[model samples]
Target: MEYVTLGKTGLKISRMGFGGIPIQRIDADGTKKLMKMLVEKGLNYIDTARGYTVSESFIGEGIEGMRDRFVLATKSMSRTKEAMAKDIDISLENLRTDYIDLYQVHNPNMEQLLTVIGEGGALEALKEAKEAGKIGHIGITVHSLEVFEKALEMDWVETIMFPYNIVERQGEELIHKCSEKNIGFIDMKPLAGGAIEDGRLALRFVCANPDVTVVIPGMYDVSEIEKNMEAVEDVSELTAEELEAMEKVRKQLGTNFCRRCNYCQPCTVGINISGCFLFQGYLDRYGLEDWAKDRYGAMAVKAGACVECGACETRCPYNLPIRQMLKKCAEEFGA
Candidate 1:
């Protein structure tokens, strides 16, 4: 229920924003019901991406009548001006809104970022969209620390979204700089993309950082919304017990566990990279050997299938050695 101005953008939004990724798992009607709950609970900030498969459209359906009550934000991966313009229109049509509150450049790398700011780049289209009243503010979502750092220097960036969780505090210093520069810092993967099992503790850890303008946890279920609300609404300071719990989470998860963002898709050989890692973690860490093996068997492409093209490693935001990890899984699973 606590509200804060999204720095530089001047938009007042709830600290806990609704992440639109999980909506892809549910139908429009389900999303509509969840949207009603979001409005009733006063979580007025929404985040979605064009790449999130039907998420934007479902949100549009869900927020049809309650558009005025929310500050809607969405992103696209288009790098060219023409592509960005087209994506903007598509986003509008899908969101069922004429004016988007914020439009972001989605996870561009060094070369792409340079290209985007260059002639006939996506930034040109984003600027045009703002001028045309199609969007209110311009922001960016980055997985690379380099991109995040570079984005801070760009005058066009009003907000920056990055993964910040109990296990991944690598951006802690840069995040503080965001507050100093008056740029809104939107926290993505506050739960480390499901690596951190304790949702309440994860949410609490994120909300404790005053620099984070908002934290968007993907929600498809109303029950999740209620539990997240409880975590975000608690205004008290982090107790010693809570801090200890966070440390325990870090030690347990380590840095190598997959966050399941699925950026490493189209695995060159059809390997289910994230799924393989997920099942492997369950088997290795949790000792759920039978269940994990059952699920691993269900995957059409197992870890042994990895040709070690190293494509997934480049795409991984966390710099995970996926090929090697898969090799371990192959040795363990005997696939």
Candidate 2:
């Protein structure tokens, strides 16, 4: 595996880091297996979050004895000083470590970001933790371009995590600024929340960018790690065929496809908004009809159950046409 220094933090990490989200789908034992593979392969950067159910715990168990082998990073949604401090302790306990390599304020909007930096805010806790040696550095994860641009200007931000893939290039300019300013830029959702079917192509597309410090595509299995590792290590420009494939991907998904941020929650009818769109994508784009139908069937509240109250759209950061999209899903699945 190839490695690079995470900007400003001076921690050398693999070009392809481990994203802890998918560990929720696998057991601790499975995570241990992945940890073993990662250690053997020399991928040292691990990212987890307090919000992801059981992810931190599974990773804790996975890296039990070999904790020093990886640079552990995690984030929380807490906005206040008290909550952020408390969450740091909880994350430390969950990760079974006394110190965390990086602690990030996860995905705060512009308003929430202010609350984080205000008096009695999460930034206070982050700074205190760094001074106390509880965390090595501070960073942030963001979904909005506004927050990304703002984070670039903050001296406290050591790293920034944002979505970058074949379909989402909105942060391309800010990503360059991250490099210019010496803030490590971590790429999330390299597959655009699994919307892009060709994982090899997706991984290649993200790794080709010189500015991306590390790209974390959530991997649950060993074969995926090997494939992604190869894609990142190749260090070659996009072949003409790959360029054409990317163009087709851009045309197919367009700009409006859900990135699966799940900001649009509490679907008045309890519909799993992103889940419906995911299954719909499988059914429509991937030709996995029976498989997609089975997953869609498992959803307790189908897209047809949408009340069209326009509540979800208001919360969507991307401002997706979720109501209309759900209507199409309803028609597609006969829900």
TM-score of each: 0.98, 0.97
Residue pairs with clashing backbones, model 1: none
Q: Candidate 1 lDDT, tens digit per residue, 1-335?
A: 99999999999999999999999899999999999998899999999999999999999988997899999999999999999999999999999999999999999999999999999999999999999999999999998889999999999999999999999999999999999999999999999988777899999999999999999999889999999999999979999999999999888888898989898887999998989988988897778999999999999989999898899898887789999999999999999
Q: What are the candidates' C-alpha RMSDs? A: 1.1, 1.3
Would you list the C-alpha lDDT of every candidate in the order shown?
Answer: 0.94, 0.94
Cα distance off (Å), candidate 2, residue 254: 0.6
Residue range 176-228, candidate 2, lDDT tens digits: 99999999999999999888989999999998899999999999999999998
Clashing pairs in 2: none
Tell me the number of clashing residue pairs for each predicted model: 0, 0
